[model samples]
Target: MEFQQLASFVEVARLLNFSKAADKLHITQSTMSARIQKLEQELGVPLFIRLGKSIRLSKYGETLLPYALQSIQAMQKGMKKIEEQKSDQTRRLTISAANPFAGIFLPPILAALHTLVPEISIQVLRNTGYSDEMYKMVMDSQIHLAFINNPHEPGVYSEESAVCLIPLYEDDFVLVARPNHPLTGRDRVSTADIKPYPLLFMGQKTSISKHMLRYFEQQQMKQQDKLEINSIPGIKEMLKQTDMVSMFPRLIVRGDLENRDLVEIPMRQPAPPLVTYLACQHDEIEPHLLKIIQESLARTITELGHPCRLFAERLA
Candidate 1:
């Protein structure tokens, strides 16, 4: 079968949606369907089971997924190598990141990348999308890497998967308020300290919100007296002006903390961890380049004085 057909199959399976896969590949939905049907016919098995508006991979599709990814990756690498030979002057690296991480964490990582590969050109896009969407983009080679906060169960995809999700660090979610707020600069503040103030919350779309709700529940606190704000900067600004406090990944508020603009309320030990991962298509990037990027991330995390430990090291 042609590489295009296999590529189409992989994208559809990865996204679990025909229209999105088609949009990603810059093809019409009909064209996408034709490619998948052609591939399935050639294989003599239906790759996907269609149930009304929903679709899922069949057993055969699951078996073919990894191999299809490898084939497309190999072909793409071969093409890229040849193209690099013809135009060796510069190389481009593209990355996507969700909102707050994009602003708070990427600058240092990008700086490190620049230092490591001075001649490379870089493009950073704001993902602000679901982790599944970012996963599809990375799989399709739309972006070379992604910084994502995934709420999926850990260990579902480890080093063995075609995609490598190297976790940079995990930060405990903490409550924060403005500098002069009664809770500011305190080593720790209890849930009782938090109850009297109006609370702000992230949208439920994010894992952070789920953790926050659970934590609030555990503390026997009610979040009904809260404002829902999805934007990180918006939350930060609101905290500065009002007596409201909110939960956040400590890494995102590092600057505010250092500037004395915010403070974390003391919570009991062993808070819920918000893990940030560096995801890449393992087969798409050269091993050595991946190593350099990984090392840069680790070093940057340390330099920034974050408490996150590398996931691979933990496994070892």
Candidate 2:
């Protein structure tokens, strides 16, 4: 009948002593006897054969033992499942990302994560500079995951290391300026052509700046009138008001391009595209969560209609 009644029946049957079964169940002997008596009354059958000092299962009790055991086990399993679900509701995950991903990838990925796993909470650490630092965060277990750029570079850790890098997309740094800017209508604009105008740089430590500088070094050219503005929005606004031009990831500038506020200046020799990676320590994240992140990223890219390919598809 009741859970305690069934439980008392099983325990009393196993021990063959009401006092021992009561002690084991942490109840009084009278309480245990009451539970067993109630169960027997409900079934309309005597469960125990009482022989003065000794007791054993009656025919009815023998038939009910297996079913009682199964009922207790099922109840326990159901309780455990409820506890696990409650635990999931309170579980929290922390992730870090570079500035580019903070703008372009993070918003959609977060929306998707909420839709898929609404029970779990997410904390984001944004604008954590460079691939090497992001890689270190994952390795040190300071964060569950990181969205970084070009972790496969010379100094940064690789897939061969403890960190696993899942490539999400590649964004080429394009020279962008206001629509009415002098360089906008050019068929072929060289770095030499870009030298005269003020160049807006993100930060000396950023991947974008590093890659842009590397491209300049390779071309054996330098811009004299450089203005360093660490903020992307700041750089875009400055471009709108002034003749200054900036090299930015195409993905980040998609909206500005669509609105005709900024136009990509065709480069004769463009800087190499930066590869964005989802980095995590091996077995650090649950497989289901990782799958959700990957699916979210892929879906976001598809919805944005960005010309980027997922690493798995690239390998295929």
Compare the candidates by TM-score and give the number of the best one: 2
How many backbone collisions does model 2 have?
0
C-alpha RMSD of candidate 1:
10.1
Positional deviation of residue 194's Cα in model 1 after best superposition, in angstroms = 3.8
lDDT of each residue in 269-306, candidate 2, tens digit only: 98889888888765556667767777777787888898
Segments in model 2 whose C-alpha atoms lie over 4 Å from true places: 1-91, 118-121, 152-154, 158-160, 313-316
Candidate 1 Cα lDDT to native: 0.78
User: Global lDDT of each model?
Assistant: 0.78, 0.83
Clash totals, every prediction:
2, 0
TM-score, predicted candidate 2 vs. hidden true structure = 0.65
